[model samples]
Target: MSEQEHWDRETDLLVIGGGAAGMATALVAALEGLRPLLVEKTDQVGGTMSTSAGTVWIPGNRQSRDAGYGDTEAAAAAYMDALIGALDHTGIRAAYLRTGPQAIDYLRQRSEVRFVPSGKHPDYRDMPGAAVSGRALAPEMFDGRRLGRDFERIRPPIPEFLVLGGMMAGKDDIPRLINRFQSVGNFVYAGRLFLRYLTDRLRYSRGTRVVMGNALAARLFYSLRQQNVPVLFETTVQSLVRRGGAVAGAVLRTGDGQTLRVRATRGVVIATGGYGHNAGLRARFMPRPTPELSVACTSNTGDGIELGLAEGGTVAPDTQGPGAFWTPVSVTRRADGSRGVFPHLSLDRAKPGLIAVNSAGRRFVNEAHSYHDFVEGMYASHREVPTMPAHLICEAGFVRRYGLGHVYPGTTDLGPAERAGYLVTAPTLARLAERIQVPVEALQATVARYNDMARQGRDLDFGKGDTELNRFNGDPTQQPNPCLRPIEQGPFVALAVWPAEIATSTGLQTNADGQVLATDGTPIAGLYAAGNDMASIMMGTYPGPGTTLGPALTFGYRVAMHAAGRPVDAATGNGGQP
Candidate 1:
């Protein structure tokens, strides 16, 4: 087996983790005349990406230009300069800005991975050069039947993201589903979706008309299957084997408890996500009084980062702002009593007639800003007040119109949410404040002030609907300000929100070639990292909608190209042998 190049013991590249970055590495490596093998400790693939929105922020792509988006390299640079505001890591940024388009083009042409321009997505920040839509690309939906029986191997979306028991409801489908009775087109679409789901439920555990992250994962899985690449599931890389002071292979523990030493001649890519789920790392790097919730998969317990560190790599030091990308999450008890961690990413936070309040029922930040900014407000307000478990206050009318977190729109009976302890409801604001344990007088005062500001068409406390991002997420039908509406309706409700990570930006330090760097700033010859395992190119600042995924997929391509004996050519935005 060791003598044969194609057997289990030998391969050109050994990729650890079945997430996007690792899959991208192996797929690209296979395309470049290399024999690659991927080993994932988790039984199923995709990791945290399976539950994500699956938008990739790529500038100067062909798809966006074709969609009439006016995005340019110069404009993107200005946007980055405004958000990052430093000359640090200029080379890496330049490389990413150069290699991104090439990476997307490569995968689209050679593999099953395909992305299209999001019709109306906007940057998280409305700064200079922030085009409304061109920069963020969404993965095209893929059919799970393409994978045959392997469809079961792809991880499902977050349970709360599904509707009608096991049917996935993407953001694009929600509006149509909600308005199905109002429009014939929507009714037809909704009917078709339900029919497909009903048929799929008979054969599959969940509906297979997958979208978002599930689609992306299914596409990657299909591509690897087509290429005949071997991905050993439920396999753990116990220790890295080094030869001539460079990583050459790893000792692995198979799912059935068999030990195997696999040898790699090319390189090793660590893409097991970040330390988002690691308790010790959360204490070391996250905010004090450490957050107990994470949106990342539980398998992402700092495996890749720790592996890189043991191989002489250092944690990236150029990070700024929050180490982890933050979002407000709500907890619910599933049917079987398991905890359901639902991340509030762009569903209902920025809508009209809703306001986020601290423990004292006082408004703190702009409700229409980015989720990252929303969590930053939580941390800031927590300094002087107890804001850890803030409540998103809204009326029953707000719930019927916009829904509150996991509670679907038009939910008349609040008994289910109340019984599950997921929502608080009362007949009046005073009762609601008492129920949620906030000051009743402060709650009344805050509501009155907010209503006044809404009627006056301005936010006196914090500019709510001021930014382009804010207005984009708001209800456009509202006259004065799309994000402003008085909470005058009764049967008030409140959903508890807590700070949690959507992704970790601080990770293993690496060079422009995507090779992990030693503590002294030298690249490790045969060790590479990507996805969240690699240090964020944005210096921990989330500049736009798909910031994390954009760099993640791009660096995955960069590292794989490097291992294929070709680094990116800065001038041409493609690879060249050095």
Candidate 2:
């Protein structure tokens, strides 16, 4: 082949991965007047955002500031320190904290990105000194018409499990919506599908409009395309090209096996997501049976981390990385082999008729904690069992309210659920326990004690009354105690549950500028990482909501800012003045 043929393309910034971080970096770079090239393993853009509700849990963000909520960079950092405690990486936190507002500003100014605060959602308080609100932000709902033809290619994040329009609402707002449940406004609010269908039909023939997660992906993708940022789909980066102790370029292989030597003038940003689908990496990091509850994209194979490591990058030794933190949730599969994994609490939340119990025939948790706590508790709950599978005990009433799994009211799967052995129903707790293979006497004793506590209006053992969210999901009409509603009626059901993780965190460590770090803690020149490819700066715990996607995007912007040699904001100390 001619030398000209070997050199396919060259650009100022080469972005590996098409996820939230990768696109953010590339878009920012393009806006800064640099030629940005993005390569995605999948055929489309969006990454996990395409499959997520797309909320950005940003503490002290511009949205919060606009809402008259006071927040400073120092306050954000303080919150971080309190949350992560000893595991906190100051440099990484500094980078995210400083660049957050700038990133939001950059996107809003240069792209179709527009966000609104899901007002009143607080930081997870159990993390030391967490706050109540003035933190979380989400993309203002958008019409799918923005994507036009691209709409069919991406997956919308699942909002069906939660209440209507509640995908990005703050924790405080949840109560107001719930309180007004039986009202006319509440009926309209709850009828999201009906509203969506009517609006789309009137506006456009394509009744599929992007909102929340899909909106985020569409907005970024729109910005990326407008800026003429080159996105090469079905192309994967094989390895890094090193020269003068710095990354010079990358060796890329297209789906057709055409090798392209693309040179990078400034740097290469690796945002190729986590290693959730790679079973081999899962065994190494998780070292356990992570049965399929992880909702992460199948394309997340840790390729970016692998390529970076080959070039002398130091991988963080945190078990909190991908495959480790995500619980392998048990899900009901469709005939086409697709499965629906609701973070578990959604079933317990709005449905009001199910309770989660462990192998010991006893309720383990409040069953309505936030997704972070629910997954964490599941991991802990597994330690007490032999196979580590909890039976999701539900009733006929629960199924009738929320619609079982993918087996909606009238589906064929519902028929199976009705069959003899699939769902078990008995008159007494002892009979139900006996059928499900639990100790009958132990089950009866546990229920009686729980009933007594319910009569007294307190959960002394588990402290269930700590969160208002828990109380909301519990029966409100019930007298003294809402959460203590006994499973007295017949017709019971149990679905085996497991720990399914969404993404892995184990990846290359990076500096404040999102530059990949070497073994000696030196920043690798011309190399950067974001998203699951980089070691999560947040340590093992999720701070609030949107913990993963929020930093991924902020760091992506930082990488672009650094690459373009832009002046950093003096007030926040994020990007240094060129």
| Top TM-score hit | 1
Alpha-carbon shift of residue 147 in model 2 (angstroms): 2.1
- Weakest ten-residue segment in model 2 by summed lDDT: 164-173
Give the lDDT of residue 125 in candidate 2.
48
Candidate 2 residues lying further than 4 Å off, grouped into runs, are: 1-6, 68-75, 86-90, 157-207, 287-293, 319-323, 337-340, 345-354, 399-428, 468-484, 567-578
Tell me the number of clashing residue pairs for each predicted model. 0, 20
Residue 32 displacement in candidate 2 (angstroms): 1.3
Model 1 Cα displacement at 335 (Å)?
1.0
Task: Kindly report the root-mean-square deviation of model 1 from the true structure over all alpha carbons.
Answer: 2.1
Best candidate per lDDT, number?
1
For candidate 1, lDDT tens digit of each residue in 510-569? 887789999889888789999988888887677777787788788888888889877776
The residue-by-residue lDDT of candidate 2 on 1-578, one tens digit each, is 86445556788989999988998989888888899999998787887777676778676688788888776777767777886664444466776776787788767866888788776566654554465666777876666666677655455455433333323333333444554456877656646644665665665443455566667888888888788787788999888887688897899999888999998989899998877777766667663455555677778887887888888898756545333445425555433555556544343532344556677777776655665566666666666754356666655555554444433332223446545233455556666787778777866676666556756766676655456545545556755655555554656656666677656667778877788988898889999998888888776666676787788888888888889987354354645322
Query: What is the TM-score of each predicted model, taking all chains together?
Result: 0.97, 0.86
Error of 2 at 519 (Å): 0.9
- What residue runs in model 1 are displaced by over 4 Å at the alpha carbon? 1-8, 317-320, 570-573, 576-578
